[model samples]
Structure formats: structure tokens, C-alpha cells
Target: MAADGPGKKKHGVLFDVDGTLIDSSYFHAMAWWQAFRREGLDIEMSAIHRRVGMGGDKLIQSLVPDCTEDMQEELKAGHSAVFSTFWPSLRTFDSVRDLLAACSDAGLAVGLASSAQERDLEVSRHLLDAASSIDAWTSSNDAKESKPAPDILEACLEKLGLGPEDVVFVGDAVWDVKAGAAIGVPVIALTCGGISEAELRDAGAAEVYDNPRHLLEHLESSMIGKLMTGSLDA
Candidate 1:
């Protein structure tokens, strides 16, 4: 596709749902923990929390190197089943709806660059009820791999028909920053995902906000704001 097509989206914003937009990061960690336990891996919660943004396949390999292919599948299935029970606990952060609407009003395309599966995204979207502001979104199936790799972000870019330079990624994990860096996208990190501001900065985040509300409040001064206004030379 051409970069300057008649209907091409220019500036865009890609959001990571689990932490940046919702309060389910630890829930996911717990689900993964139970999944591993069911498979007799007995992984730690903190360890699983740190790897929450990674795809299930990569996460299983990272947490349990000795896991066989069949075991990996079983663990993932277990995690999915366990996670489904927490659907009622899923909640969006403050100003999540307003944040997406703000981006739309600012003349930028918004996309959900989540590494979650379709079922998970469906639950999130239903909870958020802000799909009208979203231009496009991607699930794990859209990418061959997930975070800390650029596959998922690349898939979002393709879906939105926007170039890497035309977007800013908003996420709440260090893995999100690494994934953005791998694809030449600046990540606006959030500490709401249980990661520290220092850790996010150390991971190469362009800026770190406390949560969706904080970012939304300072949108005009943010990298997102600068990009939307075309004031950022980068």
C-alpha cells in the first residue's frame, strides 16, 4: 500500500489493552501461574507478572524451558480457561473512554495493538464500550509472535495502514517498550501495569505516565500530543 494514499490514516495511536487500558495485568499473571501449576511447573507469581505482555507461546518457553510442545499447549489452554473466570473482574482504568475519544477528536487514528487472543479482546471491548473511537485492533492470531518482538505491533500498523513513524505506542509494561523500540515506534509507558517509572524509562520508554487518566490529562504536552500536532521533529 502507498504511504500517501487518498484515504490513508496519517498520525495514529496504538494502545496495549491489558495494563495500559485495563486493570487485568495481575489477573493475567495469576492465570498464568495457575496454568503452569496445573502442568506441574510451579512458576512464581512475580516472574509471571513480569512476563505478562509476552505471547503465551513465548511466555511458556520463558517460564518453563523444559516444557514440551504438548505441555505448552496444555498450559496455554489452562491459562485461557482460568483467565476466563476472571472476566467479571476486568475493568478499564480512569478516563479510558475519554482517552480514546480525545485521540479521535485530535485527528489521529486509534488501534488496539494487544497481544491478547480474540476472546480476551472481545471481553475487553465489551467492557470498554468505546469501539466507535477505535479504527482497528489486532489479537494474538494477527501476529506470528508477540511483545519484545515486533510482530504484533507490525500487525497493528498493517491493520491501521499507518507507518511506524506515523504512530506512538501506549503500553504499561517494559516488554511493550522493547517491542515498540524493535519496530521504531515510541512507547508511552504507564505504571498502572505494576511496573515502576524507573523501570519503564530504563526499558527505553519515551515517557511514563501514571495511568490512562494521567496521560489523558497531559495529552497536549505528551509525545502523543506533539505527534498529533506535527510539532515533533521525530
Candidate 2:
């Protein structure tokens, strides 16, 4: 079932793929761990997990603080290689398909916008079942600047022929919040990808939930639904 309506116009919802809709945060961490090892850095998986949603370039820079540009390039390449190997094992969370169905049935246009590379985004698209349901998508290659920059979200909005006011950006990372906020798109944060509610709120998320299933459960009365239906303040 689609989430409840607020008796107004419905808006599009842009989703983050990795940690928000799918359970790939730790898998990403594992891949990063292996990738870092290839470059002789032995970082802990737990440490990497905490920074999962940071874009790949930023992630390598953060995890391996002292690296030449060439080394960063190597790490990025290595991480991609390791991560691609694990794609076969990637999995989606429970009820994720149902949530996507509900959004589609509710007449909302859904977009997938992530900082992941185009190939990785494709992998995620298939894994999340977003291939059939997503109305539009923006991969890392789509924008010159990555998350925390509004370019990516703005690109999605532009591609969809929708304005910032016509969409809500749902993500599990602080970068996602900052990007959406900068573009004046309302953001709904989910903690499923390992971002904390406090962090999400502090980053400017309009509302926060544990996961999509939880949001689905309260679809009608939630801030996102109200905003989508045009019953809430901009």
C-alpha cells in the first residue's frame, strides 16, 4: 500500500542507494578495507564503516591521510576492484521492494542519486530492484562536485524536469543532507545505513527514521508525505 496522502499535490523522492535502501554499508567497508590493504594501509573495518557514505575519493583521502595524488588514485582503483568482487553477495533490506512499490503506487516519481560510480550505481540499481521502479538517476559521473555539494541533487532535479521544491532527498549520510539542504530540497534521513539520527538532524534533515519500512509504516502522517502532498511549509 502507498503511504497516506495529505490532500495535495505529491512530489518526487530521490533516494540514496548504498546504505539507505540497501544493506551494503559494511560490504563497502570490507571492500575499502581490502582496497586499503592493497596500498599497505591496515585500517580497521569498524573505522571504515563509520565513514561509509563519504564518496570514494573522499573516503580514500580520509582513511589514508597522507597520500600523494597517485596513491589516492591507486586506492580508488583498488577499492573499486575489491568492491566489484563482492557485488554478487550484496543484498537489500527487508520490505525495501514493498516500500518502492508503495512509492510508485502512490504516484510519486522516484530517483536514485548517489555518489557511487556509474558501474557501482548499476550494481546497486539491480540489487535494490530500482531498475524497474526508479524514474531517474544521477551517478557520480553526472556531477563535477560530489556530495556535500548541491550539484548532484540539482542535476537529478534538472534531469527529472523537476525543481528543488518538487522533490525530497532521502539519504543516510550527512553529505546527502547538506546537498539537499543547499538546494532547498526537503530531506528525510534514514539511520539504516549507519548514520545517527542526531547527525542527520544536525546536518539539516527535516525528519529522521530508522529505515524505509518505518517510514512506510507512517507514510501518511510523516513530514515527507505532508510535504509531498503540499500541506507543509516549504
Candidate 3:
């Protein structure tokens, strides 16, 4: 990460990896579904998908509140093992690289604030292949708390030496909107992660778009664009 010159306030965008930049939400839901099945829990895929942005512990607890600690650990391991098999098929969303590049080219710092495990994050990052435009990134290991708690976002902000007021977060889940709200950051929501635009708006998203391509096309009028043009306070 590069330091801003004296008195310069750094501005940037923090992106959620899964579902936002990468098309792995359903894969994750499936993995969790299989993990639950392994435990004889029989969790529905829809229930798992809605909690995809959360860390494994939280996701397991949310879907199976009575799950024992040992069972939670087992489920996490199970999910990880199952999810790893999908690595070969994981892919970045349309124009994900181009969107990141546009943010970088507009003189903004770019950071990935992901709640994924370190190894999983690495795989997704590899799929993104736009690392040159990224200034910093965070994994599940980087935060003490997860999405809907804002710890990962805070960790990313710290890594970039920026404050919530200086950055906008982009994500595809209601949990992401909630996380951004916790720290007073505006969240730009995308529906590509299987979330509905109405639900994203209902969660208090500053704006909603279809995907990276949709957002990139309307960048000049979006919150990110306002940040780049100095119309939105950093």
C-alpha cells in the first residue's frame, strides 16, 4: 500500500470477493449444503445461499443454531473440502478486471475486503487476475469478526490507511449492506450474487446495479464516480 502525501486524504473502494467479483455464491451454498448433509442436518440450499457472505462459523450457527461447537468446526472443514473441488470452475464476473482497473485509473486505491478463507481468497484472486490494480486485500484470517459485523471491512480500511468516510464498499448481499452501515460507509450493492435489487435497496444500499459491467457502464454517475470527481467527500 502506498501512503498519501502529507495532508492528502486517501479515497478508495473496498470490494467483497465472493458473489461480487466472482461467481461462487451458489458453489458456496452447495458446499455448505453438502456439509450440512454430512452432519445429517439437511439444510436447504436457499437458506445457505442467503448467508454466503458470512464466515463459516456464523453461517453454520445461523442455519443451524443448535449446532455444537465441534459440529460447527466439522461443518466448516467439510464446506472447505467440498468448496475446494469447485476451484477449477470458479470464475470472475464480467468486466471485474476492467472495473477494478477503472477505479485504479481514476486515482483511487482499490482493496478487496473478503471474508473467505485465505486459500479460497487466493483462488478467487487468481481467477480475477486484476491484482495489479489492487492495493490491498483481506481474508477471513485478517479479521476477528465477519460480515454484518464490519471487522473485515475495518481490517481492509486499516490496511489501506483509510477511514470509512474515505471509501465506498461494493458487495452483492444484504449482509454486505449491513456491514457497511455499521461503520457509516455507503454501500453500492450488486444483484449478481443471486440477491434481488429490491432486497438490496431495502437493506439501505446507496445504489444497486446488475453486475460489474452494469456498474462500470454507469460509473460516472455512481458513488464511485462522485468519489473520483471530488463531488463526494472522501
Q: Which ranges of candidate 3 are over 4 A from the true structure?
A: 1-9
Instruction: Name the weakest run of 10 consecutive residues (lDDT summed) in model 2.
Output: 1-10
Clashing pairs in 3: none
* lDDT for each residue of candidate 2 in 123-207, tens digit (9 for 90 to 100): 8877776555567787888888776778778777666667788778888888888888887888899998887899899988988
lDDT of 2 at 92: 82
Which candidate do you rate higher for lDDT, 2 or 3?
3
- Residues 67-143, model 3: lDDT tens digits: 89999999999999999999998989999999999998888889899989989988888898887788889888888
Taken over the whole model, the C-alpha lDDT of each candidate is 0.88, 0.78, 0.90
Select the stronger candidate by TM-score from 2 and 3: 3
Estimate, for each residue in 1-234, the C-alpha lDDT of model 1 and write its tens digit.
112321455888999999889899999999999998887777889999988888888888887887899998899899999999999989999999999999987888888888888999999988889867888888888888777898889988887888899999999999999999997999999999999999999999999999999999999999989977898656
Single out the weakest 10-residue window by summed lDDT for candidate 3: 1-10
For residue 204, give model 2's deviation from the true position in Å.
2.2
Report each candidate's C-alpha RMSD, comma-separated, in the order given: 2.7, 4.4, 2.2
lDDT value, residue 101 of candidate 2: 72
- lDDT accuracy of residue 61 in candidate 1: 88
List the candidates' TM-scores in order.
Answer: 0.95, 0.89, 0.96
As for model 1, its CA RMSD to the true structure in angstroms is: 2.7
Worst 10 residues of 1 by lDDT: 1-10
